[model samples]
Target chain A: MPGQRQSQPLLALRGVSKRFSAVQALVDIELEIRAGEVVALVGDNAAGKSTLVKVISGVGPPDKGVIEWQGAPVQIRRPQDARLLGIATVYQDLAMCENLDVVANLFLGREIHRFGVLDEVEMERRTRELLHTLSIRIPDVRMPLAGLSGGQRQVVAIIRSFLGSPRLLLLDEPTASLGIQQTNQLLDLIEELRDQGLGVLLISHNMSDIKAVADRVAVLRLGRNNGLFDVNTTSQEQIISSITGAADHAVAHRPHPEEVWP
Target chain B: MTNPLPTKARVAEYAGGVRRRVREGGLGPAPVLLALAVTWVVFQSLNDKFLSPRNLSVLSVDIVGTGMVAVGIVFVLLIGEIDLSVGSLAGLAGAVFAALHVNVGMTEWLAVVVAVVCGTAIGALHGFLFAKFGVPAFVVTLAGLLTWSGLMIYLLGPDSSISFSEDGLVASLTSRYYSAPGFTYGLAALCTAAYLLVSLRDRARRAGAGMPCRARSGIWVRTGLLAAVAFTTVAVLGHFEGLPLALLIFLGFIVASDLLLRRTPYGRQVLALGGGVEAARRAGVDVTRVRVSVFMIAGTLAAVGGLFVASRFTSASQVSGSGMLLINAVAAAVIGGTSLFGGRGSTWSALLGVLIIQSIASGMALLGVETAVQFMITGGVLITAVIFDSLARRTAASRVRT
Candidate 1:
C-alpha cells in the first residue's frame, strides 16, 4: 500500500529548527508525510508539535531547515506562500471569524467575485454542496458562526482549508474541544480524506484517536524528535513512553505503580 | 436545502427565523428604527412644528455634515477601533480649504482637493502608527485629536475665522436644492426602480443556482415599503424647498459606502479583521493594508464632512469642528445600531444615527430648551444605546456558549 504512493514524499522537513528569544521551540526536527497517509504527531504538553505545524503552515518559518514539497525545496515565508504551495492548515483555535456567517467564513480570503462584487449565490451553493459531500450538517449557511457548536466551527474550518484544493493538510489539535461523537465524525472524515490521496499531518493528544486512524505516530520530547513508529506494529505504551521520555529516564527501572501496589 | 415549502409553512419558518435572530441579538436596524419612530413621536407631541415640512427639510440638510463624519466613524468602528481625531481632522480640513482658497488665492477645486488629500494623508499616518507600530487605536487617535486641532487653530491664526463667497462651490453645497417637483419625484422613482431591479435579479440568480430565494410576494412587499418611504420623503422635502443638494450628496455617499462594504472583497477583509485580527491574519488577509485603508477612508470622509459644515455656515472658524460634533458623530454610529465591538454594521447606520441626534437637537432648539439640557438629553440617549449594544453582545456570546 505504501509503495502505491509516489516515491517522493508529499512533504518532507529536514533538520528544522526554531527558537524564540532564549527558548528553543524546535530542534533538528525531521519528518515526512506521503500522499494517502495520516501522520499523527504526539507529545507532552510543551513538546514542539504545534511549533512544527506552524512552521509547515507558514505561520512561522523555521530558523534552519530544508522543507521540500514533492521533491523540490521551497520557502514558505507567509501563510499565502503556504496556501499557494497547496498546503492548508487548521489551527487549534480554528482561526474563524465568529461574527461572519458560515458561507462568509468558508470563503473569507478567497471569495468568489465577479468584477469585485461578491457572488453570494455561487459561494452559498458551493458551501452547501461541499457540506453535503462531507455529510456535515449545518443548520443554515447564513447562520453566523457564533451560533455554531465547537465541532461545527471546527468542521467549517476544515472545509475552509479544503477550499484551496490543498495537497497536504496540517491539523493542529482538530478534536481538542469536540465531543465524543463529533470526534468520531472528524476522525472518519480524516480517513476519507486520506483515502482520496491527500497527505495529513495531525497534531493530537488522544492516544485512541491515533490508534484508530493514524498510519504512523511521531513522538516529540523536549523540542526534539524522540521516536517514530508504524501504528500497526507499535504499542500505545511505547509511544506514550517515548512522548514522556520514560525509556531514557533514570527512573525507568522503577516498578510500575500497579505492580508495586498489587 | 432548496426544497419547496407551502406558503403557510414558509411564513412560519420566516417568523421563527426572525425570532431566533432577535434572541441571538442579531437585531440589525429594528431597534434603532423603533427608537427613531419613538423620538419622532415624542418630538412631534412637544412641538407640532417638529414634524412640519419646513423643519423636516432643514433636518435633512442638518444631518449631512455630522452624518458624513459619522459615516466615516462607522468604518473605523467596524474594525473595533475608535478615532477620536475625526472632529479635529474635519476642522483642519475645512481650515485648510478656507486658508488656501480665501487667503492664498488657490483655485477653489484645487483647494478642496488638497484639503481632502491632507485628510487622507493624516489618516494614513494614524493607520500606520496603529497597524505597523503596535500603538493602540485609541491612543493614536487621542494624540491625533490634540495635534490636528492645534494645527487647525494655528492655521486659522489671529483672525480665527474666514468667510468664503456665498456662491462658491463649498457654500453652494448647502444653499442649492432641487426645488423642481419633477426632478425630486423622478429621483425617488429612479431609486425605487433600481432597488426593485436589483432584488429581482438577485432572486433570479439565487434560484438559478438551486438555492432558496425570497418569495416574489416578499420582494414586492419590500419594494413597496421602500417606494413608500422614498416618495413620502421626496414629497415632504418638495413641499418646502425640495431636496437639498447636501442631503443628496450625503445619501449618495451612504449608498456607495454600503455597496463597498457589503459587496467587495476589501470590505470583507475589513469585517474579518474586525471579527478577529489573529484569525484574519492567519487567513491570509493583509491586515495592515486593510487597517491603513480603513483609516484613510475615515480621514477622507471626515474632511468631506468638515467641508459640508463649513458650507452650511459659509465659513470656517475655530469652532467649526469643535464642541459636541465629535461626540455627536460617534453617538450617531452607535445609535444607528453599528456595533462598537466591530465586524457588524452598515453605512446607513450613520445616516439613521445622525438623523436621530439631529432630530433631538432640532426639536429641543425649537422648544427653546437650554443647550445644557440638550447635551444632557443626548448624553442620556448615548448611554442607553451603549447599554443596548452591551446587552446584545452578551446575548450573542451566551448563544455561542449554548
Candidate 2:
C-alpha cells in the first residue's frame, strides 16, 4: 500500500476554475505535485496566488475543478477535509494565538491528555524535541508567541503543520517577514521535508527563495497558468517573463513593465 | 537545545526571577494583595472596631456570596469577554428559586436545581448568539441584562420579592458555622500540606525529565510561607464563629475552578480559544462549542452565587442582584489580577478581587461614609486596578522580549 501510494502524485488539480462574482479568480488551472518534490508557485501581485492557495487549502472551494489526492478524486470543501486528506496549510497570516505559550500553540487543537487532563509535561517534551530536530532556536517553549521574533513565530507556525506529518504541505508566504539568515534556515527545512518524501507547495514572490529549494516552478499570471519550468534547466528571466505574462504564448498578456511599473 | 542548569545556577536563576518579579511589582495578584493589606491597615487605624474578630468574620462572609459571581466573571474576563447579564442573571436565578419553591410549593432542593439549570440555559442562549451568529458578546449580554431583570420582576409578581424559610437548606448554607474552631485550623493545615505535596510531585517530575525547576530549598520556603499565611487566616477567622460556611464554600469554588483552569484540557482550550479564535479553529477546536460552554459555565456559576446572596439575606427581591452587583463582580475580577483584554488570569483572582472590593465597601461603611462615596471609592479602586494590570502586562511583554 505504501509503495502504491508513493507511485502517484500527492496532489493534482485539473481544470479548476474559481470565480468571485464578476472576477475570475482562477480559471482552468491544472497543477500536480509528487512526493519528494518542492513546487514553487510564483506570480506578480494580484495574480491570484492567494486565491489559488485558498482553493487548494479548502479555505474556499473552486467553482469548477477536479482535485485528485493520491490518484483518486477528492472533494475538499473545508479546512478540516483538507487536513483529513493529509494536506496541511501554513497560511499567510500564520493564524497564531499570541497569548499562548509555544508548547500550547503547537498543540492547540490536538492536546495530549493523561487521565482526562492536559499532559503539559509530555507536550513540552515533544515541543522541545521537534524544535531541536529542526534546529529552531527559541529561547523557551514556555514563552508566549507574542515575545518571539517574526522568524521564530513563522517557524512555530510551520512546525504546527509538521505535527500532522501530512503528505502535502501548503505554505503561503512563510518567509515573508523573515531575514536572510531565517530564510536560509527555512529553505533548509523545506529541503529536509522534501527529502523525507513530503510534497511542498511553496507560494512565494521571491525568485531567490524559489530557486533555492524548488524542484519545479509554476507561474501564474492574471488568473491563468502562464508556464511551468524545471528549476534545474530554466533561467530566472524565463520564469520572470512567465510571471509577468510577457512570454509569447502566455495567457492574458500585459503591456511591458515600462508601461505598468512606470 | 541548551543544557539544563546545574543545581547552584538553577537556584540562582530562581532567585533572579523572584528579584525581577519584585522589581516588576510582582505580576499577577501581588499588587492587589498589597492594596488589600494597605486598605486593611488604613481601615484598622481609622476605626477601632475594624480589626475585631466579630467585624472581620462578618466581612469574610459578606465577600463570599459576591465572590461566587466574581469567579464566573473571571472565566469570562480571562477569555477577554464581558457578561453584563450576570447581575440580572443572578437576580433572575434567585427570583426563580423563590418563585418555584415559595409560590409553586416545589421542594427547595428541586427548585434550586431548576434555577441553576435555567441560568445555564439562558447563558447558553447568550453564548450561542454571540459565538454562532457572531453577534458582539457585549451587545448580546447587554440585552440579556435588561431582559433578565425584567423577567425577575415579573416572576416575583406584584411585590417583586419573596422570603425563604429561616431554617431551609440554602439559608443554613451561609448562616451556619462549624461547631469547633479546630476544624478551621485543620482545614488550613490540610491545604498547606496539599500545596507542599503538589509542589514536591511537580519538582520530582521536572527532575526526572531533566527539565529546569525551582530549587528544593525555594520550594520549601514557598511551602513555609503558604503555611504561615494559612495559619494566620485561620487564627484570625477562627476567633469569632470558627469558619463561616459561606467563606469555605467560596474558597472551595476558587480551588476547584483553579484546578479546572490549570490542570484540565478544557481550561487550556478556553484560554487558547480566547487567545485566538482563528488559530484554535485551524487547530481543530470547536470554537463555537468552547465559547458557548464558557458562557453557560459563567451563567450557572453566577446563578449559584446569587443563591448564596439570597440565602444570606433569606430573601429574593427585585433589588437583590441589581444596583452595583455587576460592576462590583467585574471590578473584583479585574482588581484580583484578571486582564480585561483576556488570555491571562486565574480563578484565585475572583477570591482576591472580591475581598478587595468588599473590604473597601465594608471599611467605608464602618467609617459612616455615604453610598455615593462608596461608589466613587470603588470606581477609583477599579481604575487603579486597570492601570496596574496594564503596567504589569507591559512589564511581562518586555521581559519575554528580552
Candidate 3:
C-alpha cells in the first residue's frame, strides 16, 4: 500500500478496529495521512468515519491494531494525549464560550501568566500575532464568540487549534451548515492548512469537498474500508461505488460491508 | 540631527521632540473621587453635619459589613455568578459562633474560628452542588438564604440567646472612635504606600515579561493624586475623630477582592466560563471546578460579612439581616461597575460603589432625610448605576468587531 511515501509520512493507522457494544464501528481500517496533504475520509452516516477520527485523536480506544506516528506505534488515551502529539480537533458543534470575546476564548485554558498573575498584555499581543498569521481579518479581537457569524466562529476555531502549532488537525463537518461563501472560505482554509505542511483529516459528507482538496481519499463502508485511492487517480464514480459497497464489497477476502455490518 | 548636545540630552530629544500631551485620560480613581467631592459640596451646602468628621467616620463604619459582602460578591460576580444567601449565611455563622461559646464552653476566640470554618463548610457544600451537579447557583444560594436564616432563628431561642454589652469586644469593633489624628494620618500613609507598591511592582513585572508598561510619569501622577486624596480625607477626619477600624476592614476587603479578580488564573477561568462554559471546557479549563469554586468563595465572603454585621450590633437576631443587606451588596457591585450579565468587571468597582452608596446614606442621615425619601434616592441611584453599566457594556462591545 506504500507508494513513494513522503519524506516523513505523518500518521499511519494499521488494522485499526473499534466496536461499540455489539456493533463493529471500525474494522481493521488501514489508512495513512501524509504531511502537507489533505486526506478525505468520505462515507455516508455511520460509515465509521467519525469513529476513526475519535480513535486517531484519542477520543476512543481502538480495540485492535496500531496507530503509528512517524514509524513508532503510540496509544492516544485522551484529548490531551492527542494534543501532546500535536493533533487538534474541530468538532461539528462549536466548542467555545459564546459570551466571551475572541481574545478571551483563544486563551481560555492556556493563558499567559506572570508570577501567578494573568499576563493580559502578552496574551493580547500573541492573539494579534496569531490572527495576523492566519490572515483571518477581524476589525477587533474583543467581541464575544456569539457575536460572530457561524462561519466566522469556525474560522476562529481553526485559528485557535492551529495556534498551538499542531501537526495533525481533525476537522468534523467543517462546513456542513455553512452557506456558499462560508463553504468556499472553509475550503480555502483547508487548502491553506495543507500549504502550511499540516496533515489534515477532513471528515466531510460533501462530495465536492472530497473531490476538491483531497490529495488521497479513503472510503469506509460500514466498519470495513472499501478501498483507499489517490484522489488524483480515482474517479468520483469509483469512490461512490467503494463507499456504497460496490467495489471489493464481496470478494471473500474482501467481503461486502453488508455481510459484515448489516 | 544638528543638535550637538550631551548623549543623554540628545537621547531625550532626538526621538522625543517637543512634548505635547504628557499624559492621557482623566486617570483611574479620579472620576470616582471627583464624583465624591462634587457630592460632598452639594450635600454640605444642604446640611452642616453632612461633611462632619463624626458623620464621615460613622459612614465608614456603616460600609464594613456590606463592604466585605460586596467584596466577596465581586469574585462571584466577576465569574458571572451570585450568592443570595450571604446575609443570612453570615447570620448563621454568628449563631454558630454564639452556640460554640455559650453552650460548648469554648473561648470567644475559638468560637470565632469555628464560625469561620462553619461558614467555609457551607460554601463548600454550595460549590459541590453547583459545580458537580450543574445546579443553578441562584437556586442553590436562594435555598441557602432561606434555610440558613431559618437555622439562625432557630438557634437564637429567646431565653438561650447571648448578647454583647456596650464594652464587649465585638461591640467595640463598631463603637470605638479614634479622637487623635495619628490613626488617620497612619491610614493615609499606608494607603499611599500600598498603591505605589502594587502599581510599581505590576508595571515592572509586565515590562520584564516583554509586555506593556505604564508611563512612569503617569504612575507618579496617579499615586500623587491618591496620596493627596488620602491625606485630605484624613485631615478632614482629624477635625473630629481619627480613623475607624471598619474603614480599614472595608479597604482590606476591596484590595483582596481586586487582586483575586484582576490577577488570579482562577478569576480568568471564571470570566471565561461566564462568557462561555463550552468554550472554556474546550480550551482545557476545568470549567466545573471553577464554577463551584467561585460560588464557594462567594458563600465564604457572605459569611464573613455576616460576622461584621453581628459585631456591629453585638447580637444576632432573626430580623438582623431582614432589611436590605442582600440588595445593598448587589447594588454596590452593580453601582461600582460590575456587569450583571457577567464576563466584564472589577472588584474595585464594588468598593467604589459601596463608598458612594454609604456616602449618600450618611449624607441623608446627617440632614435627617426622610426614610421614604432615602429609599427613593437609593433606588434612583441604583437605576442610574444600571443604566451606566449597560451603556458601558454596549460601548465596550461596540469597539470589538467579532
Candidate 4:
C-alpha cells in the first residue's frame, strides 16, 4: 500500500545514447512519461526520432545510459524484453502482413491455440470486440490487411498492441498517411487511451497532432534532446524552432560570445 | 427507376457480385476449376478411353507420387521460398531406402523410417544454412539439387536399381488395391457423413460465437455435392479396382496437410512469415525454427513421395525421380493455386495441380502424342496458372486501393 502511494514515472530514460557505425543516431537523450499522459516526440528528418524509439522499445538497446521502469533501472536488450515490461510499439509501416486477414494479423505471433489448433473463432470474436470498443469500423474482419485502408490498418496495428494489455504504447507516425478524419479519429483514440491510464509516447512530425492530444512535447534535434515543453504553454513557433535546431543556435550565441563571431 | 421484388433484387445482386469478382480476378480457384473441366472435356472427346474407369484409376494412382512432393512444396512456397532439392532428395530417399533395406540388411520398416529421416536431416541442413547463416534459399537449394542427385547415384552403386519384395508394405502402398464394392461405397458414405457433420459443427460454433456462418441451404448444397462426387468417384473406381491404396494414401495426406495449414498455429506462422517476414519477426515468431522445420517437412514428404514412386515402379531406379519429377511437382503446386509469390495456397492445390498434370500426360499419351508436345502443354498450363496468380494479386492490391 505504501509502495502504491509512492507514485513514480511509468518510464524514464536518463542519458540514453546509441550509435550505428559512423552515425551517432541518438545522443544523451532524456525523457520521462508518466501514467495517464501522452508524450509527443517531435523531430525533423535525420533527427534520431526513430533511433530513440528503437532504443526504448528494445529493437536496439542504447549504447549507454539507463532505462527505468517504475523508477527502477531495467535492461531492455530485445523486443521481447520490452514487451514483457508492457511496452507496446506500433511502427510507422504498421508491421502487418498484407495477405493475412484482419483476425490473423491481429494475433500474429501471439495466436490463441486450443488443443494445439489455432482458435480462429475466439480470435475473431475478440477482434470484433476490440474494434467495437475502439470505435473502429472495418468493412469485414475477414478481409486481408492488404484490402484495408491506411487508417484501418493503423487502427488494427494499434489494437494488436493492446491485445497484450500493455502499460505503455509507443506509436511512430501512426497518422502519417491518414486523411484528416482518420487523423482526428486516431488522436481521439490516443486521448481515450490516455484517459484509461496508459502512458503513450507518440512520435510525429505533425505539431498540430502533438498539440491535439499530447500532454508534453519532447523535441529532438541532431540526435540530442532540445527541450521538453508543456503542450498547453509551448508555442507552435517555439516547438518548430527547437525541432529545426534554430533554438539551439540562438541559445549557443548567449552561452559563448567568441564562438558567435567565428 | 423502379424497385424490384425482394427475391429478384437479391438474385440480381448476387449475380452482379459474382460477375464483379470474376472481372476483378477474385475468382481464386474458379478459373483453375474451369480450365480443368475444359481440359477433361477436350481429352474425353479426343479419346473415349481417357475417361474409362481403368485409365482414370491408373491416372489417380500416378498422381500420388508427385502429389506428395507437391504438397510439401506448398509449405515452402507459402513462406515465399523454393526448394529446388526436393526432386533429388526424392531420388536419394528411394536409393537410401533400398540400400539400407537390401544391401545394409536393415529391417524394411526401419529402413524406410531412416531413409525419410535422412531426407529430413538433409533438408534441415539446407534450412540451417539458409536461415542461420543468411544464405539465400535459392543458392543453398540449387547446390543441394546437384549434391543430392550425386548422393543418390552413389547410394544406388553399380546395380543402378533395387526391387522391393512383392509382399512388402512399401510395394503394397502403390500396387495394392481394394476391389470390394461394399468397402469402396461404404468409405464414400463415411466421407460424406464426416463432411456434413463437420460442416454442421462449424456452423454451430460460428453461430455460438456470434460469427458469420454459411447458410443452412448453402451447407446442405455443398454436402450434397461432395456426396455426389464421392459416390461417383467410388463407383467409377469400383468398376476397375475399387480403390487404389496409393490414391487413398495421397488423399489422406492432402486432407491432413490441408488441416495443418488452415487450422493449426504452425500453418499460420508459416503464412505470416511468408506474407511479411519482418512483421512476423517483430510479432515474436521464431523465424529460424519455422524456416528449418518447413524444409524438414518438405524433405520428409519428398522422401515419402520417393517411396511412392519406387513402389509404383516396384523398384528404386537410377532415374526414378529425375527429369520431369521436380518440374512437374513444382508446376503442380503452382497450377493448383499455390502462388509462387507466397502467402496464398492450400494442400488441396497439390492434389488439383498433380491431377491436372497427370491427366494431361495420361490423355496425351493415350492419343499417341509426342513427349515433347506433352511437356509444351504442361509448360503452357503452368504459365497460365502463374498469369492467373499474378492477375489475382494485382486485382487484390488495386481493389484495396479503390
Candidate 5:
C-alpha cells in the first residue's frame, strides 16, 4: 500500500523570474509539486527561497514565466488569489490572531459560521479533527494559542493550512522554533500529509529535516535553479554548494553557543 | 495503538486539555488585579474612603462624563492610534445640540439627533483625513481636538452658556434610572445568562472540534463567581439606589464595542492592523478602511459621552469640556488593560479601567482631598497604568515564549 497514491502534478512553474528594486530574487526557475509528495525547497539565507515561495503563494506575481496548476497556466495576484488557487502559506509571523483563542485563531478572517455568529462548534470540531489527523497533541482546543508551546503552535499553523482544504500547504520553516520532540511530531505530520494525497512545498534550513522528510530537494544557488534531485540520490554537500555559491559559503557562522542558544 | 474513544470521552478529553491555554489570556482577576494592584493598594492607603460605596457611587457618576470620552478613545488606541480632539468633539456636540434646540427651534429629540449626526459627519471627515491619507491618527485627532473645540466656541457665539432641563427624553435616557426594587437582581440575571451562553457555546465548539478545554468545574465556578460578584455589587448598590441611567449608557457602549471588536471580521481587521500594519496588509486586511472606521467610532463615542455630561450637568457652559480629554480616556483604557502598543487590548479594559480610576477619584473626594491633590493623584495613576500595561505585556510575551 506504500506509494499507492497516484501522482498528478499539483503545481508547475517554468522559467519564472522576479526582480526587486535592487536585486533579482529568482531566475530561470523551474519547479513542480505533485499530488501526494512533499517537496523541500532548500537554500541558504537570501537564496531566493522566500521570493520563490511568495511567487508560488501568490503574495507577489512573478515578473516573468508561466505557472501551471493541473497542467493549465494561471496567474496568482494576491493572497486571496493564492487561497482561491489552493495555496496556503504559513508565514513566520503565522498570520494568526494571538488575542483570540485557538478556535478563534483557526477561523479568524475566514471564520466558520453558524447563523452568522462565529460557528464555534463547527470551527472547533474541524480544528480538532485536523489536529488529530496530524497527530498533534494539543492539551485543549479552547486554550488560546498564546498558551501553546512553540511546537503546538506550529501544529495549529499547519492544520490551519488544510482548513479550507487546500491542495497544497506551503510551510515556511515550520519547525524553526520547535524542540527535538516537536520537530519529530511535525515531521510525522508532514509525511502524513504526503501520504494523504496532499502536496507540500516545505521550506527549511535544517539539513536533517530536509534529509528525513523531503522526498525531493529543489536547490537554488544565487537566484538560479541549480539542481533538483531525489533526497536519496543527492548529497547534502552538493545541495549546499548549489544553494549558496562558493564565494558566499552556505555553512552558517552561528553565534557562539555561549552567546546564542542560551 | 491509539485508543479510539467514545464520543463523550472525546469531548471530555478535548475540553480538559485547553484549560491551560484559556488561563493564559488573563481573562481572570489575577492578571487584572496584578495589572491594577499597585495603584489600588497605593490609592486605598492614600485614602481609606477609596473603598466606600457612597463615595464610589459619587465618583462613578462624576467620572461617567469624562470616562465615556475615554472609552471611545480606547478604540482608536487599540488600532495603535490616538484621538486628541475627543474633548473638543464632545464640546462641539454639546454646543450643536444646545444651539439647535435654542436657536434653530428644533425639537429636543430632533436637536439631539442633528447634533449626533453632525458630530459623526465631522468625525467621518476626520477619519478620511487619517485613514485615507496615512496621516498619523495622533496628528489628525490632535488637530481635531483643537479645531473641534474652537468650532464649539464659534458655535456658542459668545453666549458663554446655555441651560437645559433634565426631564427631556434625552435627559431621561442619560439621567434617569430604573431604581426599581430587585432591579439589580434582574440585571444580574441578564449578565449571568449572557456570559454563560457565550462561554458555553465557545467551550462546546472547541470540545466538538477536538481542540483544548478548560477545567469544567473551574469554568462554571469562575463564571459563576464573576456573575455573583457583579450581581452582589449591583444588588448592594441597588439597595442604596438603582443603577444610574448613565451606567446603562456605558453598558450599551461596552456591549456594542465588544461585539464590534470580537464578533465581526471587520473588528478583527482593526486589531490586526493595530498589531502590525505591514503584516495585516500582507495578510490581505483592508488597512486603510480599518484605521478610518476606528477613528469614527471613537468620535461617535465622544459625542455620546458629551451628551451624557450635558444631561448630568443640566447646562452647556463656556468651560463645558475643559480638562476632560487625553488623560482620563487613556487612563480608563490602560487601567482596564488595553495596551498603548496597539494590537493587544479590549473594550472590557475601558470599562474596568474607568471603574478603577473613578473609584480612586471618588474615594479621594470623600476623604476631602483637595482638587489639586486629586489631579496629582490621577496623574500618578495614569503613569502607573502605563507601567502595568508594559509589564503585563512583557510577562505575557515571556510566558508565550515558553
Candidate 6:
C-alpha cells in the first residue's frame, strides 16, 4: 500500500511566513504530512507553532507561503475555504458554546433542517450514533456542554471536526486538559484516525503524547524549523534539544558541579 | 437509549430533571411567575377593583404597546446585546405614521407600512455600524436614541403632536375586540387544541427517532395548564370589553417569535452567536448577517409597538416613546428572565415581564399612588431582577468550572 501511494503529500507547507505588524510570527517554515501519518509538532513558547496551524486552518492566512494540498497549490483565505478543502481544525480553546447542548454544538453551523426548521430529532439520533461509534459515553447528549468534563468537551470538539469527514485533521493540544485515562483514550482515538488513512497534525508540549501516537516529530524553535525526526528512530532528548535549540549549546553538554563533587 | 420506560419511571425522571435544572440555576420561569402571583395578591389586597375585569382588560391593552417593544429587546438580549434606540425608534415610527396619515393625507395602512419600513431601515443601519464597522452596540444604539428622538420631534413640527381621526385602521387596533362569547371562547379553544396537537406530534416524531420523549402524562398536564390559563383570560376579558385586538396581536407576535427563536435555523444561529461570537464564527455562522437581522427585527417590532402606543391614545405626541417607555421595555425583558448577558432567554419572557410591569403600574394607579413613588418602586424591582440574574449567572459559571 505504501509503494502504491501517490507521490504527493496530503498537505505541504513550503517556505510559509507570517508577520503580525512589527512582529514576524513565522519565518520560512517548511512542513509536510502524508496520508495515514501522525505528525506531532513540538515547540517552545513563541515558536510559531500556533501561527503555523492558524495559517493552515485558514483562521489567519499566511503572509507568504505555498500550501500544496493533494499535490496542487491552493489558497485558503478564510475558514470556509479551508472547510471546503476538507481541512478541519480543533483549536486549543475548543471554540465551543458552553450554553448549548452537545447535539446543538455538534451540528451548530451545519444543522439539518426541513422546511427551514431545525430537524432536531434527526440531529440527536445521528449524534447518539456518532458518540456510540466513538465509544464516548455521556449521560445525556442533550445536556449543556458546561455540564461536561474537560475531557468530554475535548472529545466532543474532536467529534465535531469529524462531521465533515475531512482529509486532514488539525488538533491543537487535544489532551492538554485531559486526565491520565482520558489522555490515553485520546491517544487511542488519534491512532484510530491514522489507521483510517487520515493525515493528522498533532500539536502538543507533552513528549509522552508525541511518542505514543506520532510517527514523526517536527520541532520548531524561534519561528524556524530546527529538526524533524522519525519517532521510532529518535530519542525524546533529541526532540527536546531540537525544540529548545540547545543541541549545540555548551550548557546542554556541561556536567553538573554536584555530580563532580559526589 | 430508545427503549421506552415505564410511566412511573418516566414521571420520576421528569421530576428529577426539573429539580436538577432549578438547582443548577436554570430557574426557567418560576421566580417571575411567583413575583407575578405576589404582585397580584398584594395589589388585590390594597384595592377591591385591582383585579376587576374592566381593569384587567385595560391592563391588557396597556401592555401591548411596551410589550411589543420588549419582545424585540428579548431578541437583542438573547445575543447578549442591547438596543437602546428601540424606545426612540418607537416614537419616530408613530410620528412618521401620524404625519403621513393626518398631514400628508396618505392611506392609514400605507402610512403604517412606511413607518415600519423606516424602523427596519434604521435598525439595519445600527446593525451595519455595529457588525461591519465594529462599533459597540451600546454606543451605536445610544446615538440612535438621540438621533431618532430628534428626528421624531422634528417630524412632529411646531405643534409637537398629531391626532389622526378615530375609526381609521390604526385607531381601531386598540378599540376593536371579539366581544361575542362564542368568538372569544372559540379562539381560546383553538389555541389550546393547536398547542396540544403540536406537542403530541413532536413527541411522536421524537419517539419514532428513538430519542427521549416527554412522558404522555406530562404532556396532558402541560396542555391542561395552558387550557386553564387560556379559558380564564378570555372569560375575564368577556366580562369587560371582551378580548382586545391589541392583546391578540401581542400574543400572536410572542408565539411566533418564540417559534422563530427556538425552532428555526436562523434563530439557532442568533442563539449560537449570543453564546460565543468566536465559536459561532468558527462554526461557519454568518455573524454579521445574524446580528444585523436581529437589530432589524428589534427596529421593526419597536415601530409596531409605537403604533400600538399611538393607537391607545389615538394620537402621536412627543411623549409617545419617551420617559419610562424605554426603561420599561428593557426592564420587562430582563425581568421576564431573559439574561442581559444573552444566549439564555426566550421570547415569552417579554409577555410575562410586560404583564408584571403593567400589573404593578395598573395596581398603583388604582390605589392612586404617586408617580414618583411608582418610579422608585419600579426602579427597585428592576434592580432586584438584575441581582437575581447576576447571581444565577455566577452560579452557572461556578457549576461549569466544577
| Most DockQ-accurate candidate | 1
Give chain B TM-scores in order. Answer: 0.96, 0.94, 0.85, 0.93, 0.87, 0.97
Which rank order by TM-score, best down to worst? 1, 6, 2, 4, 5, 3
lDDT of each: 0.88, 0.84, 0.74, 0.85, 0.73, 0.88
| Candidate 3 residue-wise lDDT, A91-128, digit = tens | 76757776666777777767778788877767766886
In order, what DockQ does each candidate have?
A: 0.61, 0.48, 0.27, 0.44, 0.28, 0.54
TM-score of chain A of each: 0.91, 0.91, 0.84, 0.89, 0.84, 0.91
Q: What lDDT does candidate 5 reach at residue A244?
A: 54
Worst 10 residues of 2 chain B by lDDT: B17-26
Give per-residue CA lDDT, model 5, range B270-329, as digits (tens): 777765576566566666677767777877878877877777777666465665555677
Badly placed stretches (over 4 Å) of model 4 are A1-6, A249-262, B1-25
lDDT of 3 by residue, B1-402 (tens): 112334444334322421311111112344565766777888889998787777777777888888777877777776677888887887787788766676666877777777877777888888788888878889988998899888887888765345655565556667766656666678689889988998888666545544334666778998999999888777766676666766666677677766776567776787776676665665667766787677667767776777678787777665456648888888888877777877766778777878888888888877888878877887887897778667655754454333
| Backbone steric clashes in candidate 2, count | 0
| Of 2 and 5, the candidate ranking higher by TM-score | 2
lDDT: worst 10-residue window of model 3 chain A? A253-262
Query: What is the DockQ of the complex in model 2?
Result: 0.48
Give TM-scores for every candidate, taking all chains together and pairing residue i with residue i: 0.95, 0.93, 0.76, 0.93, 0.82, 0.95
For residue B69, model 5's alpha carbon misses the true position, in angstroms, by 2.3
Clashing residue pairs, backbone N/CA/C < 3 A, model 1: none
| TM-score (C-alpha) between model 5 and the true structure | 0.82
- Model 2 lDDT tens row, B1-402: 536667677556546645644554345566778999998999999997898988888988888777888899988887789999999999999999999999999999999999999999999999999998999999999999999999999998898789989999889878898737567778888999999998989877766665656788878999999999888878877778777888888888998999898888899888887687777777667778888988998999889988988987899987667857888899999988888988888989888888888888888999999989998988999999899888867865675432
User: Model 2's lDDT to the true fold?
Assistant: 0.84
Off by over 4 Å in 6: A1-6, A248-262, B1-18
lDDT of 6 by residue, B269-332 (tens): 9999878999998888889999999999999999999999999889999888795789999999
Q: Write candidate 4's Cα lDDT for A1-262 as tens digits.
A: 2342237889999999899999988887899988888999987778888888888887789999999999999999877788889999998777889889889998887789999988887888788788877777776677777777777787788788889889999999988777788789889988988888889999987777888999899988778888999989979888876766668832252332222110
lDDT of 2 at A23: 91
Lowest summed-lDDT stretch of 10 residues in model 1 chain A? A253-262
For candidate 4, give the docking quality class from DockQ.
acceptable
What value does the lDDT take at residue A31 in candidate 2? 93
